[model samples]
Target: MELRIGNKFRLGRKIGSGAFGEIYLGTDVQSNEDVAIKFESVKTVHPQLAYESRIYRVLQSGNGIPNMKWYGKFSLKTVLMLADQMINRLEFIHSKSFLHRDIKPDNFLMSKAGKSDFGLARKYRDSSSYRHIPYRENKSLTGTPAYASLNTHLGIEQSRRDDVESLGYILMYFLKGSLPWKGLKAGNKKQKYDKISEKKVSTSIETLCEGHPIEFATYIHYCRSLRFDDKPDYAYLKRLFRDLFIREGFQFDFVFDWTVLKLPAITMPKPSTLCKCTLLILSTF
Candidate 1:
C-alpha cells in the first residue's frame, strides 16, 4: 500500500538508510514535487529526525543550507566553488550558534550546495547569555572518521575549527579522489576507526597536500591553528580559494568537470550578496 504523510505528501519507495532510519522519496500532493522524507523508528534510542527538523527551521534563512524539505563532482574548480559554498554554510551555522558536527562529502548535496544530515548538530553557545561553550575533552568521536579532525579523534570537544578542518579534508579528498586513511585495515570497527585516527594524526599537511597548490596546505594549516573558541578567519580562508580561482583563470560559470563530460548536472546561479531561497533535497539517505 502507498503510504501518505501529512495528507500532503505521498511516500514512494525507500531510497536509502543510515544510522538513524530510512529515507523515502515522496511527492507533495499539492505541488506534485518530489521530496525526501526521513523517518526515524519510534523505538530507537537516539531519535534524530525531530531534532534535525528543528535545526532546519532555525537555519531556513541561511544560504547554502538545505531547506526543510530537502534534503558531487570531482575537480579543482569544482572543489574551489564547493569550498566557498561549504564555508559560507558553516559560517551561517556558526553565526546561529550551532555546530554541524558531521562535515563530509556524503553529508553534502552536490548541485544544491546544501549541507544535510544534522543528526549530530550541536549548539555551541548559550541561548540566553550568548556565551561560548567551555572546552572539554574525552568526548566520543562523532561524524565520519575519514573526514574528522585530529582533535575529534583525540576526544576533545569539537568547535568551529573542527568543522573547518573537516572541510579542508573534504577539499583534499576532492582533489585526490580519496583520502589516505579511507581503506585502513583492522580487526573490528573500533580498531578500524582507531587506524583512521592514527593515519589522520600522522599524516602531515605537507604530505597530505603534496603536489597540490600551496593554498590547500595553507587552508589546512589555518584550520589547525585555530583554538577551540577561536573564530575562523572565514574571509581570509575564502579569499585563498577565490584568489586561486582567479589566478587559475577559472570562470564563475559553475561549469564543473562533470558538466563538461555531459553528465547529469545542475547549473548553480551566480551567488548574490543577499541569500537566495534555493532549497532542494537531493541528498542520498
Candidate 2:
C-alpha cells in the first residue's frame, strides 16, 4: 500500500486523492517540464473521469481546460492553491459540448505558477464531452450527491443537461464558497432537490462568477435547461452570452463567443463548424 514517487521519472509533490486514485505534480524526465499524473488503481467504470479527460484533450487542443499531459502508472498531488484557479478551468470546461458531472473544489488543481493555458483552451474549441452519447443513452448516471441534479439524484437517465445542473451548483459554490442548500432538510428526494432548485443562483453568481453576468446566467439557465428530454442549444447560449455583454454594458473578454476573432471572414459557402456541433446535438440521441 505504498506509491513509488521517486522513480526515474522525477516526481514533484502530492496534490490530490480520491475514491479511485491520486494525482501528482510531476516533471517529465525527458523534457524536464511539469506534468500531471493520474493513476487508476482498480476498474472504477470511470466513464465520466475518462470521458472528462478525453474531453480535456479536445479542450486542450483549443486551450480551454486545465493542461495535465501525462497519465502515468501512479500519481497523486502534493499541493493545492486558491480556488479561483479551479473556477477558471471549470468555466472553460462548461464552454464545450459536454457537461462536467463533478465540479467540486476538490477536483480542481492549480497549474504550476504562470502555467495557465487559456490561450490553448480558446482555440476553435467546442464541447468534447459529447463523446459519451453512446454510453449514457442507456442510463449510466454517475456523480456526487451534493452536486447532482434532480434526475441524477433519482437515478433517472443521465443527460448532458444533468452535467449543466451540477455545474450550476458548482458555480454557486464557486461564488458562495459553500452550498446553503446542503445544510437544509427535506421530506423526500424531490423535496430536497426542489429546495436546491429554489435557491437563487444569481445571488450566488453575483459574488462568484467573476462579476460576469454571461458566465453566471449560463450557469443558471443551464440548471433550467437540464430539466427535460432535450438538451440546451450551445449556439444560442453562445449568442446569449454575447448579447448580455452588449445589453448589460458589462465589459469582459470572457463573454463566450463574443470574443470570436475572425480568422479570415472567408465565406464558408456551407454550414460552419459551430453549426455542425449544434446539428450534432439536435440530431443525436
Candidate 3:
C-alpha cells in the first residue's frame, strides 16, 4: 500500500512496526530522496510521535544527531562511529535537561542516517536550575530489561548516568551480538525482568566483557560509578572508544556490519545534501 504525505513524501512499503506505530520507507517526491516515515494513531495512544518531533526540532542544530529531514524523523555507518555519534546525541539531550529513559538497540535505528525514538524520554529539571533532582525508589522499570541499568531495576529515579550506563550495555550488545541475560526464564514478564535485573547487578564487568574488548568493561565500570547527580564527562567516554579504534586499526568510515553483507549498495549523499532541511508540510488525511 502507498500513502502520500503533502507534496514532499510518498510513503511506500512498511519497514517496521511496534507498540507505538508503523514505519514506512518513504520518498521525497521533490528531491527524489529515500526517507523513513513513521505513522502513529493519535486515537489509541499518547502523542509520542509529536513529542519525538519536538525533540528532533531541538536537535536539528546538534552534531552527530540524525537530521530532522521532516517531522517525526532520522542512522549511523559503523559500530564505533555509531557509538561515538550516539554519545554526542546523549550529551545534547542531557544539555537540554532531559533523560532518555529508554536506551536500547531497537530505539537506536541505524541506517546510512541515524535517529532515536524518544517516546520514553522525560525532563528531569530545567537546564538553568542547579538544584539536584532527588532520587526516588519504587519507580516502575522504564527501559528494556536487557539494556537497563541496575539503578533502573532498583526503582531509583534515572539521571544522566543511567543513560550512559544503558549505552554501555548497547555497545556491548553490538560487539557480542547477545548479552549474558538474553535467555533468562521466568513464569511471567515481571519475574523475567527481575531475573534479568538480578543478573545485571550480580555479574562482574570482567565476566561480561570476557573474550571481548577490555574497553567495553572499562566503559561500563565508569558509567556505573557515576553518582546520581553527577554530570558525565562525555569527552572521557568518547576517548575510550577512540583509543580502542586506534588500537584495532579501524577508520571511522561509513562501512558497517550490514555493509559487509550481500545487500544493495548504498550511495551516500554529500555532506551538503544533509545540511538541506526539508520543512514539514503535513497532509490532512
Largest TM-score belongs to which candidate?
1
The sequence of per-residue lDDT tens digits that candidate 2 reaches over residues 199-281 is 53323544434433345556565655554445555555445444543454433322112112232352221211111000000
Error of 3 at 250 (Å): 1.4
- The digit string of per-residue lDDT tens for model 3 on 12-60 reads 5557766565566666666777776664543324546667768777876
Off by over 4 Å in 3: 1-77, 111-114, 260-285
Candidate 2, poorest ten consecutive residues by summed lDDT: 276-285
- Of 2 and 3, the candidate ranking higher by lDDT: 3
Candidate number with greatest lDDT: 1
Per-candidate TM-scores read: 0.67, 0.35, 0.64
Pick the winner on TM-score between candidates 2 and 3. Answer: 3
Model 3: ten consecutive residues of lowest lDDT: 272-281
lDDT agreement of model 2 with the native: 0.40
Q: Could you give me the TM-score of model 1 versus the true structure? A: 0.67
Against the true structure, candidate 1 has what lDDT? Answer: 0.71
CA lDDT, every model vs. true structure? 0.71, 0.40, 0.66
> In each prediction, how many residue pairs overlap at the backbone (N, C-alpha, C within less than 3 A)?
2, 18, 2
